[model samples]
Target: MSLRSSYYLPPQQLRAENLDSPLGLHTRNPQLSWKLRWNERGAAQATVRVVAAASCSALLNRDYLWDSGELRTDATEITYAGATLTSRQRVYWQVQVLDESNRITQWSEVTFFEMGLLTLEDWNSQATWLGNHGITVPLYRLSFHLDQVREDICTARLYSTGIGYYEPRLNGNKLGTQALAPEYTDYDKRIVYNTFDIEKQLCSGENVLGIILAGGYATRYQYGTPVFRAQLEILYHNGQQQLVDTASGPWLVSPGPWRDCDIFNGEWYDARLEQRGWDAPGFIAHEGIWQEVKPSNPCSSTDAPKGELVGTYAQTVEPPK
Candidate 1:
């Protein structure tokens, strides 16, 4: 057979640490894997080359963070041994392969993985847990102005977790498409935080972040009130960075429509109690309606549910259409 036709298709189903292009990868050195597709009965991968870069264009230009020069092995998975990874770092990668007969395939499509906070200290020292102590289910909002930011935003990420379940919104829209997050865990033992890319959700002038909290694990298992902690990191093209977290910003909280919410007992929401435009920019609540959020914890002691904080690496659940 001609070399052109004999070459197997580029590797497919690229994954990092067994997750497809996962975000918030907590591992400092994650394993990479791919599947080989070929019609030949005896088709086999004889050699492989993997390249990782900070960006797609950099990968295309061969400015790689790490390159596994061709290895004469049939393994479909390899460990990443690149430059030290840092919090919120994004790495793009691709692979090339050679068939048993040494016929080569084109570079595989690029995929990426984003590093999660590597240490507990990665969280801002001032970031604190905030909650509405008197409300069953609370809607929290933080409004900020970005007009004063002189540098263009390169990217933005939101790292958050709640003692209960949470749905985070930016500018009146949900931050991610998934629901039922930050993934359920034993509140007293461990808590999982989710990372969301919010670059597109941010506006130039003013932006409002809204979070709806429901009693999931905190109330159901821990028998305590729900609280949330989050930080929004904005990176600028000029290397400047900005952070908006629960502690640094003036945040407001109000009772939400969801009442008597429980993961096992079910939730109660009253449309009549809905506060319209509460999550939108320029919306004002009555003086007594929305109040400042107080620092709260699931346990009586400070920062209760005093457990290990971890990044969500497992698959997220999707709400039904």
Candidate 2:
């Protein structure tokens, strides 16, 4: 029997851009890597082949977006040099290896990485910062209707970040598994934006977007007000597109149940003060309770406490499984 049949296993722990199946990967040239498992210590790869496609089925069927044909090297990681990737594009890929004895191994398990907003212009031209200036812990909500389009929805992506930490909800459901995000950064330098796949959360019409912002990392010795921005892009089967954003939208903000919140001192919340169904559709707000948000300019203002918005590089910190 060959060494492949006796000792070698398929490449395990595949990663893209140093992340496992990452979403909203902003890099145009993401690197791919895998760990080899073999019984023999000196066993080494002689060649490698990487294949990528738009879908898993397409990848398995050899419908490639990019294929690095039989590279004569033992490198376990390679950078993607495929067709130009666009924003929100999901690419699936797998790898195969040839041993030093010319024995080929089975393909590695498929992994994927999604592209985020590629250009700075994509953000500057699209999103606007909306915040309640004086409120320490504010809940921002926007209710919008999605009319039936001619084509079916292909995908929907929501990109968001806050000067402080934020919890986002769509139609009363929390956005992603991550908490305490977008991850903390130097308020004077840059901000991390997180992307969520919200296609499954969306309904036919009357969708509600809600976010609760708290001073997680943006505050220390003194309290700091939080600001938030988000953009949702909907793509249809027919290549049609629609955008919903905090900018130029009728977004409302209200003080949340948290009377006082501090990183060191902790939060004080009253369940009796909660606004039921505020993050859901068809919830009528009590008179004078919610106020319109103010637009903040992060780009032009030097005194603003925020920074340049960029895609997050850190893996989401999830609760213990």
Clashes of each: 0, 0
Stretches > 4 Å off in candidate 1: 1-6, 39-41, 147-151, 294-301
Note each model's CA RMSD in angstroms: 3.1, 3.6
In order of appearance, the predictions have TM-scores of 0.89, 0.86
Give the CA lDDT, 0 to 100, for residue 172 in model 2.
Answer: 91
lDDT of 2 by residue, 1-321 (tens): 113553357788999877878888777888899988865677889888899999999986789999998899989999999898997789999888878887777778888899887776777445666664577788888887664542378888888888778999999989888888887778667888898888888888689999998888777623245767788888888777788756756778888999998767889998888999999999887758897754443333443455666776778777786
Q: How would you encode candidate 1's per-residue C-alpha lDDT over 1-321 as one tens digit per residue? A: 112443567789999988888878888889999998875788788888899999999987889899988888999999999888898899999988887777887678899999988788998854667764678888888898763353488888888888788888888888777777878776767888888888877877778989888777777676467878788888888777888756756788888887678777787778989988888888886778887754433224455557677877777888888
Itemize residue pairs with steric clashes in candidate 1. Answer: none
On lDDT, the candidate that comes out on top is 1
User: What is residue 302's positional error in candidate 2, in angstroms?
Assistant: 4.7
**CA shift of 117, model 1, Å:** 1.2
